[model samples]
Target: MDTDRAAAVDPIDVEVGFLTPALRSDLLERWNEPQRRYHNETHLRAVLRAVDALEADGEAFDATEVRLAAWLHAAVFDPTESENNERSAVFCERVLDPSAPVEEVARLVRLMGGHRVEVGDLNGAVLSDADLAVLGSDPETYDTYAADVRHEFAHVPGERFVAGRIVALEGLLERKSVYLTRAGRDMWEKQAHANLNRELGLLRAGAAG
Candidate 1:
């Protein structure tokens, strides 16, 4: 499904027995925080849809855990906070049902900090790929995503932000493969590389100038 269409749907629509109405409202409110330019409910929906898309493409994973992770991945987004992932993970562990794979869900949420997943980690693979799926979006969408990220960090000085952004982009480029799953590779690998390279070049050039 397209990001726009997927993002338009409320994340509460995704069926999960563990997610009570009160909890869902709290999570949705976290995502809708005014400071969030990109890590909002829309991004959460896109990630959930991406998980479904990957599964539909035959990627094996634990759906309930992955979707839970997806919902809580950016649940504590604060552009100024370096520990959002850890905070998010802690929050996930605190609020999830006792029977839920709370540890697994928290692990997946923490993985978002770097998108690094070890081989054979099916749940991690799915969640990581879904979170990074935006990197492979079509040019216009990717551009918008990039702009939104900058806006989220608008308080940073241009030089510092560009320097930091360059580091982040290069880290992704240096990954053996930006996407972890077979389906993720087939769907977005090449486009993700292209998008990263294009953006990296522009940032480097701007820095040099």
Candidate 2:
């Protein structure tokens, strides 16, 4: 079975029922905050769709773990701090039962902090690709994402913000490949590169001006 079909039918029947209602409510509340414009439920839904597409291919990812991690990954970002991933992982651990083996969740959360870890497994690759798919979206979608990201650090000075964002953009550009899945890379790699280049040009122009 292909990943898309498999992911759709494969029921992620975890005990997420315990966390679903409260978590959803909390997430919704958080989404309403202006600071969460980029990390809103809309972004979560897009990631979930990407996750489903990857799963349908019978990829080796742990569906339940990846799904949970995707939902919880940005739970604690400060918009100014570098420990957002670590803080998110810690929050997941605390919210989940101590007896429940959440090591995979923690590992995935940590992996989201940066692109340093090798995506050796199907699950890891899927999660990583989903996170990055935003960069490969249509120009309007990507532009909205860029704006939201800038809004996230509205408190920072323009130079500091642009410098930090440029560093992140360069890091992605330097990666072996931003989209790990074969399908994702095939379909989106060129577009991602183009988008990055365009953004880099804009950043340079802004800095120069």
Candidate 3:
């Protein structure tokens, strides 16, 4: 299980030396909300690690903005709310300086909604791929992840839950690729397709039942 789990981890860790202690603390605190269970510190850390791995290949990208986006991506999502990603971006802008380049941050934040953003730009591609790496993880890790996400939306009716999840899964399927990095795509694309297919199949079965 450990070997299988480790295989899914991105092989690098970004140095966040530029992040102030206060800023780091604030980001951590904000992500502690119950609705953010699956997208919390652990998720941020994993994405950052993946970004670092991608950077090791000498990719030209803004590390700071990417890290910031990873930290703030899900900070505004209330699974029940339609504009959660936009609201989250607004919150991120407020937390940062008014003079900061809000456009990039806002774009990155909004990109977290679905896989379409995977093809946006180099940074967008990296961050989006990292955010979704879990989908291609081994069965044990993937199963645990699915449970975590479902638990976050446990308040919704069973029918609503199934419908919502199917929509999300299909969005991923409609994407050109789930992982933008060549290495990531080669390693995980098949797994991600399988995972999405299984989830969609389950949703169909649930709807039929």
Candidate 4:
């Protein structure tokens, strides 16, 4: 099992370093919500770790803004809802520290809606790559992630879940490159393509079966 379970973390978790205690607690509450499976604290920690890894690998960006955006990017997730990114951005605006780059952080949070960071958007690129780093995970880890995501939408019927998931996976496959930052591409792009293609094949096989 993935070691970073939400149950293992305290509600007052301060692992993200830059957030205020109050804001961190609130964000934890939102992320650790019972309905969350894939988007839980585990996902949040993975993204933050990816951000740190990208920086260590020489991907330059404003660390504070990107990390802050990472913490709040999915702060309003709901498996049944499509506007979680916008709602998360609104939540960021409502609670982020004034001294922080409020608008930039919110913009980064919003960008996760599509993971489509435009060129010249250094912060957006970093955040998008970090958020998507899970795609390049080893096969075992990627399988676990896929299963958790399926559980997140357990409310949906299996047929609907398979159909929607196929579309999402195909969309990523169609992208020229899954990761925006050079380090991200070097580290995860090929593996991400492999993982996505493998999952797509499994889904297609199941659908045909």
Candidate with maximal lDDT: 1
| Superposition TM-score, candidate 3 onto the true structure | 0.82
Off by over 4 Å in 2: 1-19
Which residue pairs of candidate 3 clash? none
Candidate 1: count the clashes: 0
Better of 2 and 4 by TM-score: 4
RMSD of each: 2.5, 3.5, 4.3, 4.5
Candidate 2, position 120, lDDT: 69
- Candidate with the larger TM-score of 1 and 3: 1
lDDT per residue as tens, model 1, 65-121: 888888889888889889999999999988998998899999999988987788899
Rate residue 89 of model 1 by lDDT: 94
Lowest-lDDT window of 10 residues in candidate 1?
1-10
- For model 1, the stretches where C-alpha displacement exceeds 4 angstroms are 1-12
lDDT for model 4: 0.87
Rate residue 116 of model 2 by lDDT.
Answer: 54
Tens-place lDDT per residue, model 4, 37-137, is 99999898888878877887889899888888988999998889999999999988888777779899999989999888889999999999998999999
Clashes of 3: 0
Would you estimate the TM-scores of all the predictions? 0.93, 0.85, 0.82, 0.91
What's model 2's lDDT at 6? 47
Q: Once superposed on the true structure, which residue ranges of model 4 sit more than 4 Å away at CA?
A: 1-18
